[model samples]
Target: MRVVLSCLLMLLFVPDWMGEPRLPLMGKRAVVRAAPIALDAAHPARSRVGALVWLGGVRLTSPDRAFGGFSALHVARGHRVTLLSDGGNIVQFTLGPDWRPRAIAFGDLPAGPGTGWAKVDRDSESMGVDPRDGSVVAGFENSNMLWRYTPDLRRALGAAAPRAMAGWPGNEGAESFTFLPRAGWGGGAIAIGEQAPWPGGTGRAAFRFTGDPVREPNRGYRFSYIPPARSDPSDMTVLPDGRLIVLNRRFTLPFTFTNTLVVIDRGAIRPGAVVRGREIATLAPPLVHENFEGIAATREGGRTILWLVSDDNQSVLQRSLLLKFRLDAPGTPGSARP
Candidate 1:
């Protein structure tokens, strides 16, 4: 009786990030329910948080069991959004005129390394999308691979296993990914490990690929990045101005998650460079709190529009939240390093 009770208690106290791995969800198309949420629950009129202006927010829910666990997000023209879960599931939806979710669809990766029998085989953690052609490059965690896919993400094109990522801790590998528009940086892609510290320093390992990471895995270089204190990088996206918006997440005791947004200047990235961007915004209690793992930015009417998606880990204790914020200027304050 004591052993059984001990096991139950251990399960109850497990951290939010310790949620059980989920299988792929290939559900049918249906509208997802969204509840408009205030940025500041206690003060509904408040909208600003740190350097961001909360434009809108929503708590997304669905009867489908696979509706949550979104880890990476992409917002395209006409507010069409595609969310990729770490479990290799994909959810595509459009925002109605009123910002409600519509035309929702779910899909599982057509093919991945190994038999899709185990979660580790398909643990896709981050992705980068080509702006011109809509092609996608997915970064798998446990396998430490980069896989390219069609615009619809229904078919695999090619895949590669970069040598630098071979040593990244399974769960912490390739959590931050983006395609660099900066020609000076090879105009290829950048991927940063979530928590694997560099061999010689405290920074995490980051890599720059000269072309399709899957096609030219050996044509680039590696660097290091110092994220916010005690935070792990989850996702990142490039801006029209050649800057990067990185989302870092933290989980605390008693099941709490907070996110920090950092912006790195285009000039700071280079071969073997150790970069730490400036802090832009902080998302936490009193204002908001969730496991915000994905961040995407785009230019709209000359203003930078930022979108964040949370990974609920498919736990009833948490929520799948989608938020929008406006960053008035691209040039942010001083850098942060610790």
Candidate 2:
């Protein structure tokens, strides 16, 4: 009886062992080495009007507004840009002739079970648009829910579409996702989670979905895990070469830490690929406003440009900062590469 009691106590008191390591905290006073650049003003990367443009650091109107929690910002081939707010709102901003945001429409997302408008409970993180059909897929934070919307968004604008994917274990919040066009391996989709259960760490994952969206079990889908500890990945973009560039934010005191950029080679990720990762760039709090969340890649005058944004949390101390960088490759920038 004593042995049995001891075993129970051990189970209760132990740290709940998981296979993954705990994410490290960025200690206070970490300097942000990257310089801040104005997003609206003309610069080397923004001089051309017809080139692909990347912008960030726009302030939110209110604390409840999704402006600060910009999790996903995507530009389609036709020059259409859609931004998804993690704070339960989807804002569609049309691009003008010069690639700048023209008209903006704001709408609420269908509330799921155990969700609220407040930051403490809201989800709705990353989003992807179907290149072939213009359909939308959104991933919810703190829940294992993946929603799909047909091109008829006007009819089902605020309504939650059918669940296309699920079954993520733990408090794993699906944050960002990008789709690989039908090239090979059946044209798969890649997603990143803020954190996972056994791993007790944050990382990015890649998935291959069966063409069918309605059937049970969703056959032919697989996951490739990339372990980047203490790195809460909020967004991801796939480069032309197939490498994944992940934007990660660290937590030190609930809402403060350095933001990091990581690059994972295409071959390094596969089913059960050991999940190790390397950090290429670290953005200190001072360099960027609080809560840098979204990231995207585009071409500007034959140069590859990387854009990053911050989630201000609607706090006075924070500002939405959009910064741009010129990249030679996924992990080749001097500020980002180790």
Q: Pick the candidate with the highest lDDT.
A: 1
Clashes by residue pair, model 2: 23-230, 32-284, 56-322, 57-320, 57-321, 57-322, 280-336, 291-311
Candidate 2 structure quality by residue, lDDT tens digits, 1-338: 99999778866875453323222112222121123354334343432111222343233343232345566766654444455666655555554443345455555555442335344344667766655667776666655555666553333333232232354543555666766566543455666566553234223444544452322225443454554566667788776566677777777875566776667776665654445545665665334335777777767667666766666654566665555565654333333322
Per-candidate Cα lDDT values, in order, are: 0.84, 0.54
- Report RMSD (Å) for each prediction in the order shown: 6.6, 12.3
Worst 10 residues of 1 by lDDT: 329-338
Give TM-scores for every candidate, taking all chains together and pairing residue i with residue i: 0.89, 0.66
After superposing candidate 2 on the true structure, give the runs of residues whose Cα lies further than 4 Å from its correct spot.
Answer: 1-67, 77-80, 94-101, 110-122, 151-171, 197-207, 210-217, 220-229, 253-255, 330-338
Off by over 4 Å in 1: 1-24, 182-186, 330-338
Give residue 221's error in model 2 in angstroms: 5.1
Model 1: per-residue Cα lDDT over 172-234, one tens digit each: 889989987745454789999999877876789998887768888867878889989999899
